[model samples]
Structures are given as C-alpha cells and as structure tokens.
Target: MTDFVQSARHTTEALRDLFEATPLQRNDHLSARYGAEIWLKREDLTPVRSYKLRGAFNAMRKMRAARPDLGHFVCASAGNHAQGMAYACRHFGVRGTIFMPVTTPQQKIDKTRTFGGAAIEIVLTGDYFDQTLAASQAYCRDQGAHFLSPFDDPDVIEGQASVAVEVLDQLGRAPDLVILPVGGGGLASGVTRYLRAAAPGTAFRFVEPAGGASLRAALEAGAPVTLPRINSFVDGAAVARLGTHTFDALKWADPAQVLLAPEDRICITMLEMLNVEGIVLEPAGALSVDVLPVLADEIRGKTVVCVTSGGNFDFERLPEVKERAQRYSGLKKYFILRMPQRPGALREFLNMLGPQDDITRFEYLKKSARNFGSVLIGIETKQAGQFALLAERMNEAGFAYRDITGDEALAEFLI
Candidate 1:
C-alpha cells in the first residue's frame, strides 16, 4: 500500500473507538431513476450529523498522543467543523475554544455548545469567516494552544480518507465512480488519494457549488486563488479559496472532472430528496446528487457512490428553498403590469389568465394617476411554457408589462 493509503487505513481503524462507520446503503429510489447501482454514503448520519467529526477525532487523538502535554485546542467555523471540534473536546476531556462569525445562526451555536458541554468555550467574533479564522489563529498563538484547521491540515485530510476506506470495505469492491462535494477539498483530496492507491481503476468526479467554485478556479489557475466575491447560499461549502494542502494533493485531477452546480438548481435536488425520498440534505451535502443528471449517460448501469456530506439544514430555510426551486424551474414568476384606468380594465386583465395559472401575489404598486396604475403580480403555473403563452397574450392585448423574474438585482430589491 502507498504511504498515504496505509496512513488512512490506520486512521480508519483508530476511528472505530469513537463511533461506528457511517452506512453506505444502496439507494433504490435513485437506482430506479438513473438505471444505476446508486449508493449514498450517509455522512449525515454521523454523531454530529456530518462527517466532520471523523477528522476532528482522528486529528485530536494523533496530536494528543504525539504531544502528551497538549491540553487545549482551538478552531474557527460557522457550522459543522465547530460542532465536530466541540464533540472532540468533550470526548477527550480537553479544553477547547471555538470562534464563530457573528452572523452564524443561533441554532448552530446552541448545538455546538450542547455537543461540547463544559469542555468548550464559544467566542463569537468577526463579521466574516476570514476575520473569525484570523482571530482564532492569533488567540491560539498567544495562548500556546494548537489551532485545528477545518480542512487544511494533513492529519485532517488523512482522517477524511476514512470515508473512502469504509466505502470500499462495505461495497466489497471499488465503485465505478465516486462523486464528492468540494469546499476546501479535505474530503475530496483524502478520498481520492486513498482510492487512487488502493483502487487505481476507480474514477472520481468533484462537485462544487457554482457560486463558490474554488476548486474549479484553482485548477484553472494552476494554483489556489481567492475569489473576489462568493455567494453564501450554500453556506456549508461556500469557500472562497481552496486550501493549499488540499490543492497539492488534488493537483493532478482532470480539470473537466470538476463540475459546478448552480446554487438555485441545488434547491431542486434538496426538495426532491426531501419530498420524494423523505431525505433532508443541506445545499452543500446535496452537491454530488445534484450533478447526477449531468452525468446520466456515463453512469448508466454503473455503480455510483455519492457522498451526502451534511444534514445541518434548518427547517426555517424551507420556504426559501422552495421559492428558489420554483424560480429555477420557471413554475413561478413576477411581473409589473401597467393597467389602464378603464371601468372594465381589471376584468380584461383577469381574463388573460389561463386555466392552469394561479395568482400567488397581487398588489397595486401605484394608483395616483387616473390614466393608468402599476400592478405587482406573482403568478404560479403548472407548466413552465405557460409563461410564454401568457406573455404573448399580454402583448397581443397591448397590456404593457415587464417580467422581472430572472432579473437578480431587480428581484433582490423588488421581489
């Protein structure tokens, strides 16, 4: 075995003392839909409801053993990593300090505290993640404590390789393709390294949130480069830059193998998994599965494994997810209409609605002028093509209207 694979096996073996391996269950629903043997590596079912705990446990154990006097640990994270570190602190009975962005949700902070109990101190600082990370590192340096990186450390990468080890053992053979979700690239790097050494024939496809395509950018640049701006819709995997260590390990991957998933399109996958299969996945965790349709031809009749990375979704975001899915699928739209001030003008406009079209929202934006009034309307239809017909009817009737459904900037301000 290669050195990295050997080390990964050792880490996997050692991790058993903390928790049982996450399940690699064959998904009948997905298999039937795609004509493939589809398996979901349920990292969502882990103790922390994420695979992050594996890396935290493995790294802490190794660090404590090597430096017997190490008594404290520090880390900065907005979600999963914070919970993992908290659980590890409680498990090892060591003191830990966790730094989180001020904008992090209260639910995540509460859960982290619950997992860590009295073993951890939570520090809420900084408006953004970079600020929080820098603060955590400085605190660690000043206090002589070890700062635990979420994915940039070699030990953490080795620990994440355990996911691949479990998959190979549970399946009894290498999968034809392993679909991995990439953020800072710890899990992707580790899994690829281990699998490349142990089963060179296996293939890999890396998925990233389109709004935060850090890995794709790095591969294109031939090195890691911070994106000037990033959308935080997929909060779990919305990293601006790929980690240096992770990129080093994954530098050889084919640029074409990296796929970027639209953040709004991922909402469709999240809703499908929740409604049809009774499975809930956060946007980041659903990345691999979201790209399945794009790879339908290549994966037909092949054994495919998708790593469902995390399930830290809050029910409060359900409405937003549904709205995004509707917008992406063209089932919903918003338009501003100029209505004539004639006696039967309202009736004439109402008559333009097709049988399947339903008005979800209607409001008069302006009525000061007697000649015409502006109306803000939101319509939902059973079919996406209905919008084209509706537009044609509006044009033929000489009803002035502007569709603002796909206008991001305008929608943000008005919709």
Candidate 2:
C-alpha cells in the first residue's frame, strides 16, 4: 500500500510537464442544497476537458521510456479517451492511429483530429464500437504499435491515480466521502486504491449509469460480469463490463456502496450545473452530482468530494437532454387522448388544461370511426400535480387517455 501511493504521488508530480493540476473547488450551490461541505474535483477542467489524458500520457511516456523504438500508438474510442490519446501522442511526437465507430459524431472526430494535429490519423470503421475496437486491435498487431487500453492496463491505472493524489494534496486532508463515477472502473479503481492507501479514514461511494451497473454486478457476483444490455446515453461511462484490472482493485467495495444514476435524472443535474454554476457537463460528468439527492441525509454536515469527470458535451443534444430531464422531473408528459369528432370537443378538452400547462405536441393519429379519433398530446407544465388534476377533469368529462411519457417501447416506436 505504501509503495503504491508513493508511485501514484510520483506520477502526479511528473504530470506537471503536461498541465497544471486540475482545481479542487468547494461548490457553494451544492453545499447549501445538501447542507454539507461539498467540494468538486473539477477533472472536467483539464486541457482535454477530462482526466483521461493523465492516464494516456503516463502510459505512453512509460512505454516509450522502456522501449525507445516504440513510437506508434493505436486506440479505439468513440469519445474523450480518443481526444486524450491524441493530445498525448502529439506531445510525445509519436504517430497515433485512432479508430472510431463510423457513427461517432463529427464534432468529436474533429476535436480529436485538432488535438493531435499532424501526430495522428483518424479512421472511421464499423457502425458499432465493438467492430471498431476489433479493427483497431488488428491494425495494432499488423503495425507492431502499442495499443492503449483506456482503463485496463496497470500503467493507465497508475496514471489515473494522479487524480486522487491531487485531491488529497489540494484539500489538505482526506474528505469524509469521495463520490466517483465508474465507467470501465479505471478512474474509480485508481482513485479508491490511492485514497485507501494514502488516507485510510476516507470513505467512498461509487456511481454507475443505471443501465450499465457493471460494478454493482461485479461486487455481487465476486467477479466481473457483462451486462446483456446497457443504455449508451451516458456514453462516457456506459461500459457493459468492468475491466479486469480495475475490478481487481475495486472488488473490495460492497454492492450497497455502489449507486445507480438514472440516465434521465442525470440530465437534470447537467442542466442545473450549466445554468446555476456556469459549468457545462456531459451526461457522464454529471453522474456524481446527479446521485447527491439520494445521499443527502447521509452526506449532511460531512466533507464530501464529487469528481466531475468530463465536459465534452455537444450542444446539439441539448434539446433531447432538456426533454428527458423535464419528463423525469414530471414537468412534461406525453399521452394518447381519445377525442370526439364533434366541433365543440377540442375546446372542452383544452379547457381542462391548467394555466401553466402548454401544449408542445398535438397530432391526430387516426379517425377510426365517424364519431372519435386518437390524438397524441404532449403537455409541458410547471408542476407534476397538474397532470393528475387534468386527468380527473378528463374522467369527469367522460374522456379517455393513456400516459406514454414513461413507456420506452411506445416512445421509441411512436414518439
């Protein structure tokens, strides 16, 4: 344990060549809301807008040191890691060939290319990530280039430990609790291992995307397990399985210590941070803060640190994020309404809406009979209770409707 922390601290010190330590700021907004001393380790402020560069740079530098002839690197990433690797490759003057799924947003591809400049080549292959990964690996083997695993490698884990080392040094003490967002478990495992060794008193709670609760599964199963399905909304942290190296360090955590951040609920946190704090956060970046309400009582009066992992969010998805957040918060809804064909029927139904209710979407599906039709209605309101009131009014008026806001299957197919 002593040797491990020593190595981590050394790595943290060496990272100064690339960039200054990311700031550890106390968050006034969250502190007041939760009645706790809430601090934010703003990993999102790094040069690459994420802590990924820490590991990438560390691994690349160490590998080059061991084998000076190794000048080429290869990686498969659809997001932040690719950018990080690109930046590091440019810094080292090494050739980097990054493979990304064809479906990757052009915004991300452009950013990665810009970061690497002449040091990297971008390849777009396969519609899915798994296929892209396979292609990158084959290319790496063919060219004798080192392949960088985002989280699985020992040196990468050591690199990620730099985050924890900075947190404790900057705060001048171990926080009572450190909240982390887990993807393939690199950051969480590195941070947890460092803190456990350096400050034995510090506690931790891990957060995973609800749809990709691989850590929770690993903890319960006593080994890593692949989930059958996972929602990719939190793209940065959505991994089907925990990395073997990461799970080794994290296996000590109890299943209860892991929290699930629902994808929709994470959007609310992203909006809040952006609007209130002027901090832009990607969906994965907001996971640590998104789970705060669930730990409100437990965290009260304690010193807590939440790692905001990344901020590479593309503004193009803002509307979708807002829509999801509103739905989860009960401020918006979608339903199928049975409307009568009479001339006065539409006006009567409109009267049921409260003053704050505004119709965002309205479409007639089909006029099945001469007397009635099925209409899709979407309403946005200030409060959730208004929906119940509107439903009651509709019932009394002998109208029929079905709420489809929470129905995923129906929403994908119809909405």
Candidate 3:
C-alpha cells in the first residue's frame, strides 16, 4: 500500500481505542430483493450514530498531537457534525464551542449537550446555517482557536477514510460495488479514494438527496457551486454546496455514477426499513438503500455494499415521515371540493366514497357562499388504484372537485 493508504490503516487501528469498528453485515432481505449479495456497512451504529465521529475524533487527535497546548476548538453544525464534535471534544478532554442554527430541534440540542457534557459550550445563533457558520469562524479566528470544518479539512477527510479501511478488513475482500450517500462529499471522497488504491477493480455509485446534489453539481460544473435552494428533509446530507477539499478528492468522479433520491421517496425507504427490518434510519441514513430499485438491473448477481450512514432520527418525526411516504405512494390524497350549499348535498358527497377509502379530513372553507361552498378534504385509501375509481364515481355523480394532493403550492397552503 502507498503512504496514504498505510496511514489510513493506522488511523483505523487507532480508532479502536475510542470505539469498536462498525459492523459490515450481509443483508439477506436486500440481497434477495435485488438479486445480489448486498452488505450494509452500518455506520449508523457508530458511537455518534454516524461516521461523522471518525472525522471529528481524528481531526481533534491530530490537532492535539501537533499543538499539545491547544485546548479549544470550534465548529458549526445543525445536526450530526455538532454531535460528533461534542463527543470528540469530551473524549479529548478539550473545550469545544459548537454553533448551531437557532432553528435546530430541541432533541438535537439536548443530544449534543449530552455528548459533550462539560467539555463543550453550544451557541445558538442565526436562523440559517450559513450565518451560524460565519459567526463560528469569526469567533475562531478572533480567539486564535482552531476551527474544525465538517467536511473540508484534509485531516477530517483522512479520518473518514478509516471507514473504508474497516470495510476492507471486515469483508476480507472488496465487493464489486460500493454505494455511498453523499452530503458535502467528505465520506464519499474519503471512501472512494482509499478503495481506488486498495480495491482497484471495485465500482462505485454515489447517492445524494435530489434537493441537495452538491457532488453531482460539482462534477458537472468542474467546481463547487452553491445551489439556489435546498430541501432540508434529509437534514444530515442536504448540503447546499460541496466542500473545496472534498471536491478536490472527488474531481475525477463521473456524473453518471451519481444518483439522486427524491425527498418524498426517501421516506418510503425509511418506513420500509423500520417496519420490515426493524431498522430505524433517518432520511439521509436510508439514502444508499433507497436507490436499490433503480440499480436492480445493473447489480443483479453482483456483490454490492451499501453504507447506511446515520440513524440519528427523532421518533417525533415519524408522523411526518409516514405522511410523506403515503403521499409518494399515492395511498393518501387531498382535494378541494366545490359543494352545493343546499341540504342533502353533504350526504350525497359522503355516499360517493369508496368502501376502502377513509375521509381523514374535511373542513369548510367558505361556509357563507350563496350557492356553493368550498371544502378542503383529505382521503386515505387501501391502494393507490382506488383513487382512479373514486375519481370516476365523483365525475358520474357530478361532484366538482380538484385533486390537490400533488399540487405543491396548494398542499403547502391548505394541507
């Protein structure tokens, strides 16, 4: 092995002092379903419930070794990164200042506090992460404290490479394919870099949340480019732009190898894994597995390894996840009904419902309409096909209604 690969191996060995290596398990369910030998590198089972801890711990350790007197570090993150930094700081017995967006969930804030204990101080600032990041950097520079980047630093990237090192040692051989979930490109870059040297024949597929496809954008643009907007549903992996250091490592990646997972569709995978496999995965954690159906043809009979990146999901979001999954599968729907104000109209509308359909919501929007009233209605059905039959019956009964389930603007405003 070259110097970098050898160093990564040493780093993996050193990590044993902090925590045991995560499992690389053969998932029979996924294997059977995909017609391939599918294994999951369970980074979700890491001490911080993410691979972020590896980078955080490694960066902190290297910094401490170089500057023995360095006692303070700062980082900005809204989720996993903050928790990782906190955990690392506590391990190193160093002080850390973690900046989080003002809108971060209470559960995340509490978890970070728990991980750091007295070793870290959390400063909640700015409504957006960019603002929070800037504030943290400014504080670091002004105080002459070392700043820890979530994904940009070389030491952090090297730390992440340890994941690949463990994979090789555990699997005993390189799989034909490696599927990775991408955020700012740290894990993808680190893993791919090591694998290219260690397992030259292995292929790779990178998955990114559609709303935050920074890696794909960077590959296409020949550099990192900030997206105009990002959907934060996959909060752990929804980065607006790829990191410069990460991009440098991944510059040779082919755009075709990158796949995008829709935010809504990701929820379906999350629910399926939870219900069927008893595996609770956050949206970002499920990214590598969520794209299996799309790769079924190519991966048939091949050995595929998917990295389940993180499991820091809050159970409180279960309802929202279920709702999104239902909507994506067409099992749930919402509509605006224009109803006659006259008596018996309501009963007639109720009579048109299918036996397997349940009305979950019905609210009168304009009760004072002279001849007609507008009503907002939500319906849940046993099957997606039921909606077509329901629509046909509605038409036959002369009921005027508009399906607003897939209408983004109306759904946001009304539902």
What Cα-based lDDT does every candidate model obtain?
Answer: 0.94, 0.95, 0.93
Q: Which residue pairs clash within candidate 1? A: none
TM-score of each: 0.98, 0.99, 0.98
Model 2 ranges off by over 4 Å: none
Residue 129 in model 2: lDDT: 92
| Model 1 regions lying over 4 Å from their true place | none
* Candidate 3 C-alpha lDDT tens digits along 1-415: 3887988888888889889999999999999998999999999999889999999988999999999999999999998999999999999999999999999999999999999999999999999999999999999999889999999988899899998998898999999999999999889988999999999999999999999999999999999999998999999999999999999999988999999999999999999999999887889999999999999999999999999999999999999999999999999999899998889998998888888999999999888889999999999999999999889888998889999988988987888
Question: Model 1 Cα displacement at 150 (Å)?
Answer: 0.8
Q: Can you give the lDDT of residue 132 in candidate 2?
A: 98
RMSD of each: 1.2, 0.8, 1.0
* Tens digits of lDDT, candidate 2, 1-415: 8888998988998899999999999999999999999999999999999989999999998999999999999999999999999999999999999999999999999999999999999999999999999999999999999999999988899999999999988999889999999999999988999999888999999999999999999999999999999999999999999999999999999999999999999999999999999999999999999999999999999999999999999999999999999999999999999999999999999999999999999999987779889999999999899999998999999998999999999999777
Model 3, stretches more than 4 Å misplaced? none
Best by lDDT: 2
